[model samples]
Target chain A: MVTMRDVAREAGVSKATVSYVVSGSSLISEKTAAKVRAAMEKLGYSVNHTARALSTAKTNAIGVVTSFRNNGACFDLSAGAYLYGIAAAARRHGYDTMLLTGDDGVEAIRSAALSRRVDGVVVLDVLIGDARVGALKESGIPAVMLGSPADSQGVDVVDSNFEAAAVSLVERLYDHGHRSILFIGWPEAVYERKLNYAVRFRASLMEACAMRGLRVGAVYAHDATLGASEVIPRALRDCPSATAMVIHNDAAVVGAPQAFERTGIRVPADLSVVTVMPDQLGEGMQIPFDSVGIDVDAVASHTVDRLVERIGDPEMSARVELLDQPMHVRGSVRAAHED
Target chain B: MVTMRDVAREAGVSKATVSYVVSGSSLISEKTAAKVRAAMEKLGYSVNHTARALSTAKTNAIGVVTSFRNNGACFDLSAGAYLYGIAAAARRHGYDTMLLTGDDGVEAIRSAALSRRVDGVVVLDVLIGDARVGALKESGIPAVMLGSPADSQGVDVVDSNFEAAAVSLVERLYDHGHRSILFIGWPEAVYERKLNYAVRFRASLMEACAMRGLRVGAVYAHDATLGASEVIPRALRDCPSATAMVIHNDAAVVGAPQAFERTGIRVPADLSVVTVMPDQLGEGMQIPFDSVGIDVDAVASHTVDRLVERIGDPEMSARVELLDQPMHVRGSVRAAHED
Candidate 1:
């Protein structure tokens, strides 16, 4: 196998120069860097990551605890996209991700935490009182969650402002002359579990309706996508007075418009629709729905920053960061009828 | 720090008994197992995974390398589903999954492979003559790839029979009285990168056409989802003699029928369309085209099996496995002259 010595010999440079080029520490001339790269490629030299990590005590890897198993269901596309975003951001920061799933409730988290397999962890689909957070804290493993803040001390959290985003969607509908609007959301079991964001969404929508004196028609979807078809029709049938709808689920937002079209309902003409989660609904899918847009990239980048901070300074106090969600009006929503 | 001692104390048993119960090494009474589980849960005691792995040199974590970074650039739904399947299978076998992207490349694969971070890796979206493969092999790491047999050496591979599937699709079209059929595929750069699947697909279709003494029309999709507005009209104008279309791209199949509809052409009646990829097109999409079905579950399960085998016995010779693709005749393809 080609090593640093081989590259150094091929480049006619000292072994230290080759090491400096590979480590990317200290200044090296661009000319020398190119020479080193060419020589390394020619010699088929690849880094010995195990030896490197052992020597440096830095694998440049971030453990990602995807807690879908504890949540007892598959994460929908939007959730999956959020994870992909986190992984992408970690990669940009010169870190790779290690995924932890059902092992969240057991020794899995602690083992990964203590083994120094990762510099820190980016926890996804986190529950409000996740045990892994406690385990990570006890093990002194720096951690950040992509969902609602866990109460564990010293853990950093980056999450969307679910309550604020939901309220903004409701307020946008009101501003658009919508007096009677329907709120399509995830199941009640999700909220009952105190999954902070889900509960917050429900509370914010209800509070927004009460403050505005608007007739809020709320329907809890059975599952993410399948329920959209069933619940939308029932919401329309039960409350024929509703002129607009706000969806918090991504799958439902993508599927609802098609469901409405199948039922011969023209969007914004017969009924208007809007979504709070917009990342997974691609323009190519052609749903054309308006949205309360949470910048997925922002959330991902912020989470990486927080995790990196915690990794560097594990003794820092627990911090919670909430990103703002902006509203993007598209073709699916319109002014409500004023008779 | 609840440990085996705590479980033993609570369960009124010895530490070895607790160990046996936790590891399931020896057959223990169900009543004793329940007692240990209850005691462990009550005392918040979980196994010490780090110590165990240090002694055994095994971490029940597998790495999944995917193309999440190239999301919109490629229709990665099939790839995503395959990763999900690997995760599910890993869980069933008492393992967790770690996700690694291309950004980290050799370092990530090597660290995850050798530092006992992951027991094995399932490499997806592998290019022909990949450097990562060579790196993994050099490090004596167990690995599997989701690509063709040609690209792999002494490494297990799980892939679809792209050439045979494409030929079968062409044969179906010919059987339906279509003399001229156009094959829309991924960009030529993908083929040039020696992905070879697309190249094989085209070759098979050409061979099939030659066997039937017919000339097959073909087009290269600039993107995964061929926008019918651009490609379909161009195909029609360029090959007006063509009566049928076969799409290997998933997203293109979703939109091709709509492009035909917009041009006042009926599906199967005006232009018959068949896709090589079958997921994502079956339901809830605008264009429901016929397909040469690729079994996503089979691909996922078989890859997992190979990965597990490689992890268990790293010195075993690598093998390639290909799953069968069946044809699903939907409304998109029909007897061509019937229109």
Candidate 2:
């Protein structure tokens, strides 16, 4: 096996320089980094992961634990794009990802980080009063949470700014002269479990609507097709005075138009609607709608950067991150009383 | 940390027996497995992964690489549910999974498996003449391909039997006295790139149609709204005599009913259709259709089983496995000339 000394000699650089390049601890000039890489490739210096891990207490790998939220069944998932973002970002730092699944994310973190298989961990879909966040606080591992947790002061956290998204989306409708709007939020079970985003979005939506003198009607919609079909029509019927709808549930929105159509409600003609969802989901819908979209790539970039930074400097305090979620108005909203 | 010897002592078993339990090499009795697990939990033996990996030449983690396959952009991904199955299975085996992305699957395999970061590998949506398969063959990594490759002799292969599915679906339609069929195949580029499933399904459908003395009108439809809207109706017009439709493209089928609806063609009245898709995708569609489904759980279970078996015994020959895909007849097919 080629050693670091051999790589340093081949590149005419110091051992520390080679280490810096490999570990990504400090910024090396592109020229020097290129030279180090070429020398390592030529000398066949595949880092002895075990040896290096022991010396630096760092593994060029990030632990990512994904949690699926559905009924008891966890197979109904959509974390591919989100994970693709994190993995792409990690690869840029020459790091691989260790994936751990199942609901017991706290245990996965403990095993992976305690065993030194990963330098730090990135957890997805963090909930309020998250046990994983508590586990991280206890483990003292350099980590980042992709979803905002309830108590995230001391931990690195990045979220899509759903609080702002909810407020702005409703404000947009309020400015458009809509007073009474029905809000389709995540299922009651999701809020009961305290997924931070779903609960926070509802609170912000209601508060912002109130500030703008708007009457708000909030209802829960689960992601399943059957759940959406049953709940959306009921919500529409319950909110006869509402002239607009703001949907934060992606699955519900997929079937919401059909539900509305079956109830003899015309989209944008009688009631306007905006959504909080990914661009792809909105684009695939038969009824075009305005949306505050999740920028997965940006979220991934920020997450990896924070995790890498934490790994490099364990003493650094946690960060609060908010991603851009611009609303794309696509003719889904109309003036109130257009009828 | 509690050591392996400590676990062995607590379990009242030899250290080697404990190792066998951890490595999953031998079929330790259920009673023994339970005792070992209980002891490990009691003593908190999380297993020093790096040391164990070095000693046993096993990481107890399988490497999974994903490649996105839609027009140059990689987001048209469906590998999530498939991966969920694998991760769920790996957890059952007391192992975790390592994920790598980008189109450089060949390199990911070379580095991940060669470095012993993973005991084996699983590649999804394999193409003909896949470089990943070639790299695995040369590297001697315990691996399996989720989709069939052109040269699969020396590699473990597990694929949803799309060829059999196409033949059976078409034969069922033909049995109902439908002699003229319109087949909407995958995009030309997908077939040209030689994705095994697309090419094989098309070939099988054509051959089966010929065997039935049926006239087949084939057209390629890319998974895009524009493509489906234009191609489906055009194919319907061209195949005026065709009474049944077979679609292998998921995206095209999502929009096909609307296309037919616009052209004054009523489903199962003027035209009957069957699709090759996942049950979830078909269930989410506006127009209900019969479907031959890919059971992702079975694929995941089979892929993980073969890879684990190979990891336990490297000399084992490559195996070919096919998953059973039942067709769900959902009122999409009707007798020819019924109208």
Candidate 3:
């Protein structure tokens, strides 16, 4: 149990010299190094593996910071794919991924960077004016966010084009002769937290509504299943003339058809639905949803690739990349009748 | 840039001494420390943040290694809860969680341990005879596995009671007067890989079936949805009189009833189905299967707790814990009759 201190004392040298000689990290004269080596032999001291790793190369690990709020206290289906994608991409880059879930947010991110546990950070579920972006920038650690904020001051971001999808969905319904539509958005907490995607999509929705002179009512829900209970009844009460709907919540997608069935409102016959979701839910319904895909894997790969590039060149200019949003307008929409 | 070497040279001290004086990782005589400090003032050498971190207390970070396989390189609904559970527990204990997904399983694990990136590791989706167990043991790093392996030589393990669930399920089917039953298991690759849960569950199923003198046939499929296609036709074609089925595949669970409906088979009228899954799927189905619950949160908490305890005492003998297996017998099973 000889400590490095004992070795230093035996060698009659400073502790840093002993470390330098053992790690081969710093330039030391052969004579001084020989003395440190001999002292180590005499004391039978072993270097900690951490010191050994630093001598050869970096940890070769990356940090991925996923929002604790995204999954709440338990699991959420949405965030899982993005995290898995990032890990797979990191592995391909010969780096292990470490998921950092710190409830304290920016401070926790600062700790991970300062500790040198990871080379760079990938922040998921990015919000506007995120404190972690500022923290990562100030620390000079390379970072990438999965969503882009309105202000791209110091952070690299990658996101899906939710704005385009929103505008197009609204416009497409308008062209199909639907004037009255109801928009089912995420819970108020999403926009209240000022997440980039939620805010941007809502803005785009409003822009389209204004341009087309369409009458639209918006509502929010937290749970998809229970959300439908509120969405259906409220849709009828608030926008009774509505003939089309643009839905954003996945929970609502899974529950809305079932809810409509119980309420005696059939898809296309009473109301048409367009949504952003995976194809599995869309294909399973009695009437499939006209849907836009969420390319989580593409988002993960782009974010990781950018972070790796930034890690190699810490001084590189930060950039934002948004993947194209593609829509699959299955037979969920129909020509609307005059109300 | 002025380096620690410059500080050491000016102070006429070894590099380790400068690091010791700056990081304060080790004690030095006040006179020697003062000399190094004066050299730092003369050379204007600033300590890097990494060195600054080691000067403080622990990093307060724990590494959780999840097999990218669990999520299937993207997203799998199954791995979500386990990961979410681990993150929640780590937060409660004031430990930041780092997810490690290594394509090279043992080497990646060894890398994490040797680099000193984490205080401890929580490995998920553990396999029997896993090389990581021996590697972690030899390295003397505190580690825990979500599933116990066949050999518990050095590492601690915590898992859901899959074996108990399997045995109980088979025995219950027998109690319901099911003499001839068909057993549908996970893909053969799961067993071929020697995963502890799959191997143990199948073994327990066999043991229970043997004791009851019931005739059972087993089949395996990779995809759960398509698995129903193969399983349904194969079961009745092979066993012919299999009045009950024990299903363990999630995809099969989601798809089997739909398959049954298309084939015009009524549940409990034509065939009985018993499964081990979350209640949500069963309750939402056309016919709810007799179900057994998987307590992923409990397993995650147990795994994290042990890793934390081991981090506090690396010398503690390793242990394995299995949480309870709870079952809900919906009306999916009925008394078997001689046709």
Model 2 segments more than 4 A misplaced: A1-45, A69-77, A226-238, A256-266, A283-287, B1-46, B69-77, B219-235, B254-266, B282-287
Task: Residues B1-339, candidate 1: write the lDDT tens digits.
Answer: 566887899999999999898889899999999999899889867665555554566767788876434433553445445655677788778776777765656776765654456788887767666777787787677888877635575778888888788778888888888888787776555666656466667777889889997666677656554354468778887998788888766556655644564566777677888888744333423236677776765777788888898888877877877666777666777887743
Name the better of 2 and 3 by DockQ.
2
Candidate 1 chain A minimal-lDDT segment of 10 residues: A69-78
Residue A105 of candidate 2: its Cα lDDT? 84
- State the displacement of the C-alpha of residue B46, model 1, in Å, after optimal TM-score superposition: 6.9
Q: Residue A311 deviation, candidate 1, in Å?
A: 3.2
Q: CAPRI band of model 1? A: incorrect
Tell me how each candidate scores on DockQ against the true complex: 0.19, 0.35, 0.19
State the lDDT of candidate 2 residue by residue for A52-98, as single tens digits: 65466566889888765353221232466677778889989889887
Residue B280 displacement (Å), model 1:
7.4
TM-score of candidate 3's A chain against the true A chain:
0.80
Candidate 1 structure quality by residue, lDDT tens digits, A47-76: 655456655767677877765532323234
Instruction: State residue B163's C-alpha deviation in candidate 3, in Å.
Output: 1.4
Better candidate by lDDT, 2 or 3: 2
Candidate 3 CAPRI grade: incorrect
Candidate 1 scores a C-alpha RMSD against the true structure in Å of 6.5
> Against the true structure, whose lDDT is highest?
2
